[model samples]
Target: ADGAAYERALERHAGLAKPPGSLGRLEDLGARLAAIAGRCPPPIPSSPAVVVAAADHGVHAQGVSDWPQEVTAAMVETVAAGGAAVNAIARTVGARVEVVDVGTLRLGPVPGGVHDERVRSGTRDLAVEPAMTIEECRAAIGAGARVAAELIDGGADLLVTGEVGIGNTTASAALIAAFTGAEPAEVTGKGANLDHERTPHKVEIVRTALARHAADTSVEARGSLGTLASLGGLEHAALVGVMLAGAAARIPVIVDGVITGAAALAAVALCPDVAGYLIAGHTSAEPGGRSLPDRLGEPALLDLRLRLGEGTGALLAVPLVQAAARVLTDMVTLADVTKTA
Candidate 1:
């Protein structure tokens, strides 16, 4: 991000017709948009896009979620057909939706309209072994970066992170715990409404995975990649790639719920500057969702108690993000009003 542009935006906001700081977070968001665009008056993002990275988790076998792994692929097909909540939200916000099969298990033919970038069929159970080989994890990240680059080349000015994976919350919780050093019990929460009876079991599963991968995740190891390979879902790795790519291009990246939040943690581990490019779309109801942003030092823009992934929460925030930039570009300065008077 351009620090000079950010400072200029803050000065411009103070000079706007409205009282200083009256716009609240919108003012801050506008400055951030300027910082991202390297100008005091950034262009409002008109071509926003959301990349929904779909994948499956071997941890489903651990009974962490009530939803079957098949739901991951089924939801991918639904999103491709424009029948899912994400599609509707994206449409409402005038943002395009792109679904990528980063590691979704192929029960049969892959659906049309979904990008075929599968690094593997699905990840192995993290509790018993590494979720993916280091090579596979890197491949997934590359796939995500490629997709983000393609969309940017296609004129997408803003990117939103989304994902569809049934057992992914288990992986997300594990990733959050690993990066934030938060206990599994503190980060883990009901995913897809996992029954209260199973919540304890889910927490235990995260604990077990973290314990098994302690050496790889330790600070002395400096093993962010290894940590992700051990505990992250394929979609998580891909989302990390998307964030890194967006940051590299100086574009804003709106992060969705806990799953994408976990990916953001990994992305920050890889490149701390990625944090400056991230905008938390909402405060997810999930425990990790709330904690993840706090760890990144980026407060969420909204709190609708949303936990359904697919970038729905972040898509809903697209309008707010666009409005923020417009404030800086279109709003009149206090001097204008005084001159008119």
Candidate 2:
């Protein structure tokens, strides 16, 4: 992203026919698009792609979510078949949905149409032990980076983060708590509609994980890899990779919900510059969703109280992102207005 282009965009927005700042955040978004494109009028993203990284969590054994772990692989298959919510939403925005079995637990061949980049069958239970070894965490991150590179090489101008994994939110909460120093109760939420009775247990699970991995979460600890390996799911690690790759390529990476938000924090921890390329697609209904964006220092593009992950919220925000760029390219300048007058 070019600082000069961003300043140029701000000047261009002021010279547009509309009153100064009338477009509000849309104007800000347009300027950001310009910076990412390194031009005053950024090209409207024509090939937005959502990479839905699917995995399972051994934390499901702790009964943190209402949905069973098998639902993770099942949802991956549904995503591959184009029957999931993300696929329908992607169609509306003319975006492509790519499902990656980054750590899904399946004994057979990978689902058709899904990319095979499994770091492991699934993550170990975080409440009892580290979710992934450092090597496993790095491998998942590499898988995510590879996927992002392939999509970009294939002409995806914008990248959206998505994930599917039962009990993953527990891991998300743990990661958020680890990175942000937020308490378990503050970051934890009922995942997959888990009953109120179980929500408390979910919070406790996050607390236990954080307590067990206190050394890894310390500010003076080696780096984010330890914290992530201790509390993040494989999909979470993979999404971190995607964000880093997109940032390295100087493209926008739209993040979805709380789960991806945790990954974004991990990514920023690994590479602070990665924060510059992130766009929060939406803030979900979850409590952590509200704080995640604040931690990222990026306000979400939408707030529909949506909690469903699957990249649906981010997909819905794609058209809005395109519109932001279109505003710069399509709207008439005040000079044009004067000429017509």
Candidate 3:
């Protein structure tokens, strides 16, 4: 792919565009992706779709969240009701949000427009057994990817990955430990505004969960994605599917927070080349989220210290990406840049 040459060409192309650097990083991003796609100018993003995968975690019974286990179902309703944080942000960017019940329990008629993509009622108790069966993990991942395929087919030019399962951070912490060699405490964070002091103890608890799950002999053969399925919340699994689907389809995906970052890690582990299609939307205020972009070798597009995980951060990032895409397609050449310069 002439990786080095493509990068160089992108820089030259960006400089040749009108206004020199008025558009900032967006201009750089557009040019870079254009070269990667072997296009002088790339398509602009008008219809971006953000998929929110929600589920309840078995580990929540262990007291990992400040919010109740029931909040999973409640928040799913909020998203469907169009009153959640993500809904507001998606509205701002005019990106559609779809909620998928990847593996939640206590399910009934899911809210209208919510996809009943459940692979299981819920995962097994990770403290006592593997969280999910290998088949269930694969099914959940497939569900997410399939949802992404539908959205992309619906004329979406970009995809943003988000999730809504509580306690998933515990799984993310464990995955981060395995992938980044960071201790659980190093990667764990205070989810949903728990006491700042309790965050450290929360990390220790996840460390314990990882240790408890280590007895599962099938995990190693299961791959990182499988390992996450063994401990990850349903939304995490769906995000992994979304990441893989978006990468395979070559749609740029904006990652929201540490949870999404963890999913990206697992997705890349499943397909090492998937990282090429990812954009770290913002550094999450989640305990170990700040470390994610560096883990992926990319800088975040925003840093307002966001911690909400329902794709809010990623949806907020759409305007910037759109601006970037616009730069490639609409910006003029240096010859027409400006006489003021």
Instruction: Give the runs in model 3 whose Cα sits over 4 Å from its true position.
Output: 1-5, 8-23, 35-38, 219-222, 337-341
Error of 1 at 65 (Å): 1.3
* Consecutive 10-residue window with the lowest summed lDDT within model 1: 214-223
Residue-by-residue lDDT tens digits, candidate 2, 1-341: 68899999999999999899999989989988888878889888999999999899988899888877788999999999999999999999999999999998888889789999998999998988888988899999999999999999999999999999988888999989888888889888886864677889999989888878874554433478888998999999999989988988878999999999999999988888787788899998888896657975667989998898988888889988999999998888888889988
Candidate order by decreasing TM-score: 1, 2, 3
Query: Against the unseen true structure, what C-alpha lDDT does each candidate score?
Result: 0.91, 0.89, 0.78
Residue 207's lDDT within candidate 1 is 91
**Comparison by TM-score, 1 against 2, better one:** 1
Candidate 3 residue-pair clash tally:
2
Cα error of candidate 1 at position 224, Å: 0.6
Any idea what lDDT model 2 has? Answer: 0.89
The sequence of per-residue lDDT tens digits that candidate 3 reaches over residues 54-78 is 8877877777778777788889889
TM-score of each: 0.97, 0.96, 0.92
**What are the per-residue Cα lDDT tens digits for candidate 1 across 16-41?**
99888999999889999999989889
Best-performing candidate as measured by lDDT: 1
The better-scoring model by TM-score among 2 and 3 is 2
